[model samples]
Structure formats: C-alpha cells, structure tokens
Target: MLYRGSCHCGKVAFEFKARLTGVVRCNCSICSRKGALLCAVPHESLTVLAWADDLSTYTFGNHAIAHRFCRTCGIHPFAEDVREGSERSAYINLNCVEGIDISVLSIFDFDGRSA
Candidate 1:
C-alpha cells in the first residue's frame, strides 16, 4: 500500500509502499528517546516527494545509517541503511505517516540498544 509521510511542519514529504505490519520498537538511544515505531521498505519502494534538500542527516556508532529529518521541524521521518543482509532500505517512521490508526498495528521489539 502507498502511504504519504512528512515532518511536523510539512517541509519534508515522501511516499512509500508498506503493509504497516511488523513495525519495530527499538531500544537504541536515539529511537527509544524519539519513541519511533519503524517499518522497513526497500529503497526503490520509497520516493521523496518534496524538500529533499531541506532534510538533515545524523549518524552515530557505525555511522552507516543515515537518520534523515526535516531541518524546519527537526522531525525524523525516515532513515536509510544497509542491513546485515547487504541490501539497502529505508526505515520509515510510522509516526510521520499521514493517515493511519497506529493503535491497531502489531509492533515487534528490537534489541537495538545492545547491538
């Protein structure tokens, strides 16, 4: 299914195809603090619709994942990284999705803090 996502200020926008199941709740510092529920989509499945240049990136630890956020609202709408399988994908923040009943989604807890 195609879903629309954006930052709080709407400065950044994107469209992606995801089933919205198996969203991950990670214990990593950044993710835990932000309370982000993420879902992965292959790079080809996501498209930035606007304000690509207005996004800022943050990386730490291995510095392999690019945590992309909107410069205006500082909302991290998505992140990009190559998984252990050596394939690139975007980890979409479900909080930024335009319209969806988040309460009904099945979430999986990931032990990222220990990674």
Candidate 2:
C-alpha cells in the first residue's frame, strides 16, 4: 500500500509504499509525552515528496532513531534510520497519515526509554 502523509500545515508532504508491518507505541519520554502512534516501514519503501529542506531533525539518547519534524508546524511526520550503519527500517508517525483507515491496524507497545 502507498501511504500519503504531511505535516500539520501540509506544506511538507511525503509518500511511502508498504503494507503496514507493525505499529509501535512507545513509553519513552518523547513518544509518551507526544502520544504518537508510530508505524514502521522498511527503508526502501519510504520516500519524501516535497520541501524536505524545510524539515528539522532532533536526536536524544544514543539517537538510534533520528526524529524528523516540520520546522514550521513542529509536527513529527516521519522518522529515518540515520543510525550510522543501520538502514533497517523507518517508523512513520501514523498521526500524520492522510486518507487511510487505521481502525484495523494492530499496535505494539515498546519501552524505548531503555533502548
């Protein structure tokens, strides 16, 4: 499946191709605080469409997952695997996805605070 997503303002948009492998809910500081619904996709299936330069990145802890947010809206649209040599996967913010029915999606809980 091809998923379309964007920031709150919709200035920055992207498309990813993947059959929803998994949705992760983390109890980590950032995720818990933001209440984000995360969905994972392989590295090759994801693509950024427009205004990528307008996005900003934030890292914490060992920074295994590089969180990317929109500079203007401050909404986290997608995450990338910029962890040095790891190109395993990318966890996208399901909250930013558009025109998709997520009612049937299954979610997994994780403790990323210790990762």
Candidate 3:
C-alpha cells in the first residue's frame, strides 16, 4: 500500500509503500517527548514528494538515526536510520500519515532508553 504523509505545515511531504505491520512506541527521550507512533519500512520504499529546503535534521547520542523534521512547523515527519551490516530503514511517523486511524493498529513498545 502507498501511504502519503506531510508535516503540520505541509512544508515537507512524502509517500511510501508499506503495510502497517505494527506501530512502534519508543521510550527514548526524544521519542517520548514527541509522542510519535512510528511505522518502519525500507529506506528505498520512501519517496519525498515536496521536500525542498524545508527539511531539517537532528541527531543525538551515537547519531545512528537521522530525525528529519519540517523546519517551519517543527514536525518530525520521519526518521532514517542506517545501521551497520543491515539495510537502511525509514521510520515514518504515523501521526503525519493521511487517513490513518492509529487506534486500529497493533502497537509495539521499544525500549530505546536502554540502548
């Protein structure tokens, strides 16, 4: 399935092919603060439709995940992680997805604080 998403101000928009297997809830400082529900997909499966100069990146700790956000609205639309010995991953913030009812999806908790 192809899902479309955008930031709060629509400064950044993207689409990806993914079936929402499960939503991920992370306990890390950033994740907890954002209260984001993320859906993981292959990096190659994502396509930025309207992103131009409106995207900004933030990284912390080991800088493994590149948290991408809309500079204008400060909404984190998605995050990209490139891990060693593994395929690159794109975690889309389900909150930004169009016509998604998160309450219907299975949720999984990730203990990112311990990592």
Backbone clash pairs for candidate 2 read: none
Weakest 10 consecutive residues, lDDT, candidate 2? 81-90
The prediction achieving the highest lDDT against the true structure is 3
Q: Name model 3 segments beyond 4 Å from true.
A: 83-86
TM-score of each: 0.92, 0.87, 0.94
Q: Could you tally the backbone clashes for each prediction?
A: 0, 0, 0
Q: What are the lDDT figures for the candidates, one per model? A: 0.89, 0.82, 0.93
Candidate 1, residues 23-113: lDDT per residue as tens digits?
8999999999888999999988999887657898999999989899998889999999845664789999999998888889888999998
lDDT agreement of model 1 with the native: 0.89
Worst 10 residues of 1 by lDDT: 79-88
After aligning candidate 2 to the native by TM-score, how far in Å is the CA of 38 from where it should be?
1.2
Between prediction 1 and prediction 2, the one with superior lDDT is 1
What would you estimate as the lDDT of candidate 2? 0.82
Model 3 Cα shift for residue 106 (angstroms): 0.9
lDDT tens digits, residues 41-77, model 2?
8877778776657888898887777888888889888
lDDT (C-alpha) at residue 3 in model 1: 96
Ranking by lDDT: 3, 1, 2
